[model samples]
Target: MITRILLAVDDSPAAMASARHAIELAACLGARLHVVTVVPDHSLSNLVTRMGSHPGVHERRDQAAEAILDHVVRLARASEVEADAHLLEGDAARRILAEARSMHADLIVVGRSEGLDRSTTAHILEFAGQPVLVVPPEVR
Candidate 1:
């Protein structure tokens, strides 16, 4: 009885594969899909600035997040799933957990990283109270 599903995605190819799976699953189960993209907080980015990237980097990140969410939501809808998108600002894992709790999601779906880039998925699996599905990367 999956009523709500939360999917976390980024610009990575793995995330795109995860998004596709989520959309199909949501449509199959008649569940509402909630897509989210978390951008780094401006203050945090400022503190961790390296190579003089300058301030307000989060603004560009926000725009990118919005675009990602928009694309995901559109795909979900096309798959015949009721869907919504969210653009969050903060630590990626933290924001995802918060959204899951707030939305009362029955499950959380994320992309499986190939090597050492799965921090967010690791954090979610460690801290989330709900079930999680880690979609594998698409084979090329």
Candidate 2:
């Protein structure tokens, strides 16, 4: 009964693994995939300015987010699953949860990294109204 699946991803290996799982699941369930990656909101830091690395930081982050989303979307399409890409900026967990709610997703999928005290997957699980699948890196 999972017609819509929202997948939150990043550049981590775990995220890529989760993407693969999501693609397969969507294909099996005849579901559409909503793929999203967040560009973290960065606060101005004196160190960054002093180091002359602040100028392209936002651009680079945005590009990276786009790349991640694009990769996932391509994978989903190659698997014959319909996919949409969303590039968001702000707190990762908050944005992801908001996107899921906006899309009325039937399920949420995210990757969990081992040994992290607090993770986006944890936050999404704590707040998501729908079922969430947490894929570990070793799954694939």
Candidate 3:
């Protein structure tokens, strides 16, 4: 009964792999895909502004997130699955969970990058109310 799937993705290789898996799963289940990408808040940029960083850091992040989401949506639709894209700002896990709930998703899918920042995935696993499917880096 997985009619709605929420996929949280980034631009990493592992994330792309997860996107592919999500597309396949959605097609197989005849489910719609909700693709989401989150941009961190401006706190870091504000702090770094004193050191000479530009003020458009958050804007750049937003653009990047939008680009990633667009790519994901294109892939999903190319697979013949209904797909929508979302760009969210704030804590990655919090925004993702909120989006999933708002969209009435039946399952959550996330990609684990090879790097050490597992905080987002861990947070989702610890707090998500629905079942979560984690696509690991090795799956690539």
TM-score of each: 0.88, 0.90, 0.90
Report the lDDT of model 1 for residue 81. 90
Clashes of each: 0, 0, 0
Task: State which candidate, 1 or 3, has the greater lDDT.
Answer: 1
10 residues in a row with least lDDT, candidate 2: 40-49
Extract clashing residue pairs from model 3.
none
RMSD to truth, every model: 2.2, 2.1, 1.7
lDDT of 3 by residue, 80-102 (tens): 99999988889989999999888
Task: Output the TM-score of candidate 2.
Answer: 0.90
lDDT of each: 0.89, 0.87, 0.88
For candidate 3, the lDDT comes to 0.88
Alpha-carbon error at 74 in model 3, in Å?
0.8
**Number of the predicted model whose lDDT against the real structure is largest:** 1
Q: Report the Cα lDDT for candidate 2.
A: 0.87
Instruction: Kindly provide the TM-score of model 3 when superposed on the true structure, using C-alpha atoms.
Output: 0.90
